[model samples]
Target: MAEWIYEDGIGEARAALIEDGVIVAAEIEADDDGIAAGTIAEGRLVKITVPGRRGLVRLDGGEEVQIEPLPRGVTEGGRLVVEIRRAALPEPGRAKLALARQASPEAGIAQGPTLIERLHASGDAVRRLMAHEADALEAAGWSELLEEARTGEVAFPGGGLRLSLTPAMTLIDVDGWLDPAALSIAGAEAAARMIVRHGIGGSIGIDLPTAGSKAARQAAAEAVDTIVPQPFERTAVNGFGFLQIVRRRLRASLPERLQGDPLGSAARALLRRAERTPGSGMRTISSHPGVIGRIADRPDWQAELARRIGAPIALRPDARLAISGGHVDAENP
Candidate 1:
């Protein structure tokens, strides 16, 4: 047997079911003739059964609610779409309230705890404190950094090479002031090390101080490989004698976190708006958090419908109002 507790919020309904000493489902709550606590039925996307009562709820992707039960005093076939949030609360408060109401109100009033008091009361407060601290530690693991490119001629500590960076590519121009010394292989090695350590990704062009002989260019290329341990299939000195570096994306780069594609979120709005129009042939393209938020908070969505249909729109949460045109693909988000 199962027990279902129904809660109606500003625009939704949420139900919680407890069974076998555990909460089976408490997130999505729906009210339909076919739903109860013990058995899963068709149209019942989510279900759970308790010792005596059963519960079921529907979800509309994110937060926008499409359908819910009529509030008390509002008869069936009523019009109104409500959104609700459901979660577990401590049971001690329910018991205390029951006992107080049963006992003499005047006598029990001073003895019983407040509703908020019961919700927060815990047998082990230390555990709750430790969990909060652990959450902070988990959040600290994520890290990121951004490096700005040099704008003008920048001097190296040894005054032998120079590097410049722009939005398109990084330019490494060498002066070779060291007595035309057979291309200091060690200096090229040091430059390569800095590039790898800085985590530079994308195209890099290296100018090797205008080497007099092909052997000097080859020596500089070999030195770069020795200093940088990156796996290379082949390092071919191009016609211009510049080393074209194609470094693999070594880490979970910064831009990956900053940019992303879009997604959908309003199944209810799509369904209702399409239903409101006649022969408009509208369909739910996608459902996303942003669309759901707009649906829940916005006072009216008929304007959105009208925009699509090129005419005035009619929207009624009341079941009596029939929908005519659009199709709603309600996702289980």
Candidate 2:
């Protein structure tokens, strides 16, 4: 049965839509993700970056975001209301500012819908998961799905895809030992699945094996249509076996989160595993120093883990371990 599995984890909320026992779509909402999309706030116009076109606004909470269509006569230092269009996106070295537009003066201040709320609003059966519930997310290949996003690798029958994120767009390069015609079709299908699974948006380019004939290219395009849902635009496969797709990007994708904050991502994953580890008494979480540092910086998360598992929690930084190579060990009190 198709359903959404939701978990309010230690540092983040997660949801996965399962169809035929496979994850077709998923989302991870970090607790620290600032002002979600659709939030309306009053802020001061701190700077007129683009004069009449755009500017920067500092919300009452002190977060600065880029606002478009700088309302007529609204100059620097002016107070105005704006609705968030998208949350800030985390990147490797820096983060993109959240996007907003002027809001009606009479609009009521509101927070955006949460991941679980969105799932319920979808009218699909949503099953809230608990720590002791057999780990339905993992059983549905959540870890493997995350690895694929982190590594940008997805394998199919005849070929595999190598996805790379760039400033302008995400690129998917297909490679394998299949024939040109067959490989293009297979690659397109795989790329489409990856796009939907990861919630990849904005611009995307897929490079498939060059088609031997125009018919082959059409077949490849048809393959993509079979998997990806509507509300997107794509170009027909060009002679160079390239296709471009554009989707509305309202928030950061899975890859952006995992790659943008490696230490935090690893730390949270370690904490989740620790919470689920079966034992009593004290539990020790051992990981790379950076990950341990990240966890240490968030004592609240550690306390929550301890509270949930009914045990004392300890952290040990091992220089020899990789960031994601953390393990939990239960010790006698």
Candidate 3:
């Protein structure tokens, strides 16, 4: 059975869709400092890098947006209403904003809690995530899922596929299959599921196992479309077994952020592990320096952990700890 777990912490929030006690989809809600995708705002063109082409705009609150095809009559110093297509990611040297679409004069900005809203209204058991949920999350392969999302690789029955995100589109390369036809059939299904699992959107190119006939190719494309959500288009698998899928992208795919800040994800998981430990007083969490650094960047998170557990936390930086694996034990504050 599938269930929803919504963890509302002091400084961070996460929603997980767990099927058969395993998480199949998840979203991390940002704190105040994070720039979330899907924010619509009024922006003033600050500069015209390429006149009448793409230029930069300073939105309300001093945030810059990348606006292209400058709206008619709009010039440098003019206003351009826009919506955020991609988040201003925290990655180093990642300051450019990606635009999604233009907003109407009457349009009002609205931001929703990513997947958390859906899980809250779902029929599945929805509860605040607790320490006990860790076992279920682990049993459902939380760590493995995090690793897979970080690596952009998924393996199914006959073969596996690696997802590559390009400036133009997201590509899925199928490999390591014994039967080409079976690989196409199964790969199509697997690819679709992975796309949804990672909250991927926009253009996706799936290079399936080359089949012997066009009919077989068409069948594979049809199979893929059956599971995809609405407002999507797909091309028939071509001679090269390349099928292009176009999905509506409203915000930055969760996978992108996860891949960019894996250390943060690991630290969050470690906190979850500590929260669920049966008997706990003040706890000592020793983690890899990488994860420790990420955790230290968020004093709010440390305070939240302490508040939630009703005890202080002592963080020890351990150079020998493996990635995503940390030591948690009770200790005096």
Best by lDDT: 2
Instruction: Tell me how many clashing residue pairs each candidate has.
Output: 26, 0, 1
Score candidate 1 by TM-score against the native: 0.29
lDDT of each: 0.34, 0.92, 0.73
Local accuracy of candidate 3 as per-residue lDDT tens digits, 174-215? 886567777787889889888877777889999997888877
Between candidates 1 and 3, which one is better according to lDDT? 3
List the candidate 2 regions with Cα displacement exceeding 4 Å.
none
Candidate 3: the clashing residue pairs are 131-276
Candidate 2 lDDT tens digits, 42-68? 899999998779899999989999999
Name the best candidate (by TM-score).
Answer: 2
Cand. 1 Cα-lDDT = 0.34
lDDT of 1 by residue, 1-333 (tens): 443333332122322333343322222221111111111111222322221232233322221121222233323333222222212111211200000001121321121232123323522121111211232211221111111111223234454445554345555665555633354454566457545534334566666555566777778788778766566433555445567675643221122111110111123324333433234333343334444434445444445444544544332232232221223432221
